[model samples]
Target: MYKTLIYDFDGTIGDTLPICIAAFKKAVTPFLDRDISDEEIVSTFGPSEEGTIQALIPDHFDEGIHAYWQAYKELQYMAPKAFDGIQELLDDTAKAGFQNILVTGKARTSADISLEQYGLTKDFKMILTGSPKGPNKPENIVKALKETGTNASDALYVGDAPSDITSAHAANIKIAAALWGSIIEPEKVAALKPDYTCRSVADFRQIVLPE
Candidate 1:
């Protein structure tokens, strides 16, 4: 039903939220005298890791990013692998000649680190990382379609976040809520009425790559 698959990275492809949040907290701990709440950090997510730091401590943006990367790379074991079936899904889609594109809320460096650690760097035809300004999925989604010469109708955006659903709809694309990640609230995501609600990557594969 679709010719192109657009993906989200953190909770969607790799179980990365653990390391992301941990690293973020670790990165900002020194600058903050008091403990930082997870919600406080999460609220800064529209921008990339650096942007998050910029929001929290503009004077320490560069230092915060360095600390974040140090912790992120060292804490890789928290997200040691992709969701179980993601590699196969990418492989199968490749064999079927589907265009795979990644639009992630992670900064490019962090995204590259995760992809490199997972040994799945070459899967996407294009990859758009998060901005230092704000969350730009909707605009980036449209940009991905245009860059790939794909029509919105022929593409499906597979993501785990509610914002992802909103972005997909804003870009006039079909959305499949990927509910397989550990940290996501499935019930909340489901309440948004995505075009497809997949409990696992296998379910997503069935819809997009059915024979």
Candidate 2:
């Protein structure tokens, strides 16, 4: 029954966490004169490089962002991959007339790289990258829905983080917690009580593209 599908980028559609963690550590270590712990990096990282830079090196924000990407691209081992079944899910959904939107915390350039590398650049009808202009996911979701002429009641937002659940609720849209990504703890995601939960893309396809 859903006419639209909104997705989160990093942990939802692709497995970019490991690469991002490694890249972030490499990028920020020199500035701090010490390596940041993985836990700290995960906690501090947000939807964009600017946010991460601001949190760690506000004085050298622009330079920090440049460093981050340079480190990211150089880490050949950290290349991202689309999760199994994701491409099929996207194709099926689009074929079924569902408007797809990508709402991510990633900067435009990084997001572009991810989509292009993963061969998902054309899957989404609209891609909303991270920006201070309206960094709130709920606001971005609402904007995407409006642009597509889809009502919140007729759409579902799919994501792998607790923030995604909260934002979807705030936007008055249904949310599906994607456990296959596991970016957030499973128990914690359950506590958030997203409208639906899918352990795999196959499970997701059943709910969104049910026969």
Candidate 3:
């Protein structure tokens, strides 16, 4: 069992992918003459909001981020919901003495809004958001481990993206694939060979807290 659990916010913890894509498209519309594809938007997504914005709208990165969050925050609905059983999982993990930490590409403000909306603001012990000059995901993972006083051997990083897997691996941490929150094909994910593939909450519990 792990003593620390590091999580990715979008897609993994919060179902914000749809709204995020919409916001990205809306953000770039004013700057782009033509439509931007969803794949393009997703591919450019990095560990920080500004990183993604800069990739998408290098000419007007700051303006793009402002517009993106403006559209994103204005929407009351379509923010995101915690995936099925996610709250229970977090609660259980906490009760079992694991330190829950968050590493998100969303700006701290945007991440807080979603966490508050979902009533998950208190679930994490430490939160590392991707601000304009914040550390990237891999760096955040290292920080989470250090802050929580947990070693990589005693920590598990769960996420739904290839980048998350790569980051965890780079940080010398074990990684688990959240199949339920997967955005990529299962075959593709399988090829990445995560230490564990959690198809359901039960699978997650089995791997992280087997008794």
Candidate 4:
């Protein structure tokens, strides 16, 4: 059994669709001279917010990223809701002697607020957020293992993006793709071929961590 489970926050644990779309729109409006559709915004869901913003507004990547977070923080505080059954999954995993850690591309301040607001703060052993200088998910996963005193083979990573699977593969941790979140298409996730694919929190428990 996996002793440590690392989670991705935005689309994996928290339903951040509203805030994310809002942020992207707010960040790009001034530069694009035309409104960005929610569909366009939603398509950028997998990457770090900064990276997404950069891709959408290249010349002003830094500025747009900063502005996006500023707008995002104001709106997201009230926007996030935990995915149904996630709380129960966390509880069961904890009871089964697994340690949970959150690794997100969101800034720490915003991530902390979201976790607390959704009552998820207590569910995780540690929460890591993106920094301009911070390492990517793979490096962060290695750090997480060291901090938790777990070997790579004993850890598993659950997330909604290709980046997450790539990071887990780089870190040599098993990967489980969460289909319940924002990815929209299973075929997109299948491209990564995670060790496991879960359609819901219940499926996660049964397929990825069966007793």
Candidate 5:
């Protein structure tokens, strides 16, 4: 049985796509003078805010990145919601004696706002955000394992993006790719060959805590 479960926040636990897209639009529209489509915004879902801004607006990266995060935070503060069944899954995992951690590319402040807004502040044993000091997902997995006093072999990292799967693979932790997320391509997730693929939050519970 898994002793710890580390999750990615944005597309994994929290359904913040609408807020994210709105923020991106708010940040980019003035500069581009054109409305960005939701599909374009959704396609850039996985990376850090800075990374996303840099990728989308390279010329004004320094200014645009800051603006994007500011707008994103403002929007998120007013519109944060947990994914369907996330609370139940977290409760179930806790009941089964598994430690939960949230490791994400979002800044700690933003992550805190979302977690608190969605009433998930107490769900995680620790919340690690992306920073120069903080390691990436693979490294974070090791840190979480050490902090929780668990072995990689006995832990699972669940997420919705390719990077999450890659990081789990790098850390040798079992992975569960969440299909009901921003990545509209299960084929892409399948190509990563995660230890498991969950069609929904309920499916995930069944795998993690089978009857």
Candidate 6:
């Protein structure tokens, strides 16, 4: 009896990684003389943008955060939406009597902006944003499980990153690898032996809303 569906926001619910990367570049490039590679920006992902800035630009941490927010808000217009069928899935979960919780490694501010922009602020009951210290999904998953009063055995955590798979297991719950994002490497995610693997949100809908 799966009573809960824990979700990852960036690649699972929304295609937000590109805007995040672009905004980060826009925010920090002014502080650096050299061009920052996309890979470098992505490598600093585990933590929130605050942590990303702390790691990359400690000297101007305060200013970097402020600029990043401005840039993210401005450039987010490009994304402007969530993936198709995401709202349907959220509805399915609710209709099926499963509690929905969002636990992501994204900064709280950026997460709010993205969710609001996508008109999904009301979809989740519990939304835990990222940490500046490091990847905190494992702990947050545990927190969600406890908050929902659901046992780990009866819950599923869905995410699109390899680290997501790792963190889900760390929290002792079944994980569904969401390989729908363009940037996701299917082979890499499948290699982790996740409990369920969905190549698209439609594929995932079947598991949660089977007829």
For each candidate in the order shown, give its overall lDDT on alpha carbons: 0.91, 0.83, 0.81, 0.80, 0.80, 0.90
Expressed as tens digits, the lDDT of each residue in 1-211 for candidate 2 is 8999999987788878777788777777777877688898777755476687678777877777888887766663555568898898899889989898999888888787788878998999999888733357888899999999998899999998888898899999999998886455788889999999999888889998887
TM-score of 5: 0.84
| 179: Cα error in model 6, Å | 0.9
Could you give candidate 5's per-residue lDDT for residues 1-211 as a string of tens digits? 8889899887788767667678878887777857788887666655566666666777887787678768877886545578789999999899989899998877676677688788998999988777533337777778988988988889999988777888899988899998786534677789989999988998889888898
Which residue pairs collide, candidate 4? none
In angstroms, the error of model 1 at 26 is 0.8
Whole-model alpha-carbon lDDT for candidate 2: 0.83
Better of 2 and 4 by lDDT: 2
In angstroms, how far off is 45's CA in candidate 2? 3.2
Prediction-by-prediction clash tally = 0, 1, 0, 0, 0, 0
TM-score quality measure for candidate 2: 0.94
Cα lDDT of model 3 by residue, 126-180, tens digit: 9998856544888889988887789899999988877778888899999998777
- How big is the RMSD of model 5? 3.0
Off by over 4 Å in 4: 37-67, 77-79, 133-135, 208-211
Model 5: lowest-lDDT 10 consecutive positions: 131-140
Look at candidate 2 and tell me the lDDT of residue 130: 81
Q: What is the model-wide C-alpha lDDT for candidate 5?
A: 0.80
Question: Is candidate 1 or 5 superior in TM-score?
Answer: 1
What is the Å distance of residue 111 in model 1 from its true position? Answer: 0.5
**lDDT tens readout by residue for model 4, 1-211:** 7899899987788777567777778878898978789888766544457657766899988788788878877786645578888888899889989999998877675687678778888899998777544337887889999999999989989888777788899999899988887544577679988999988878888854577
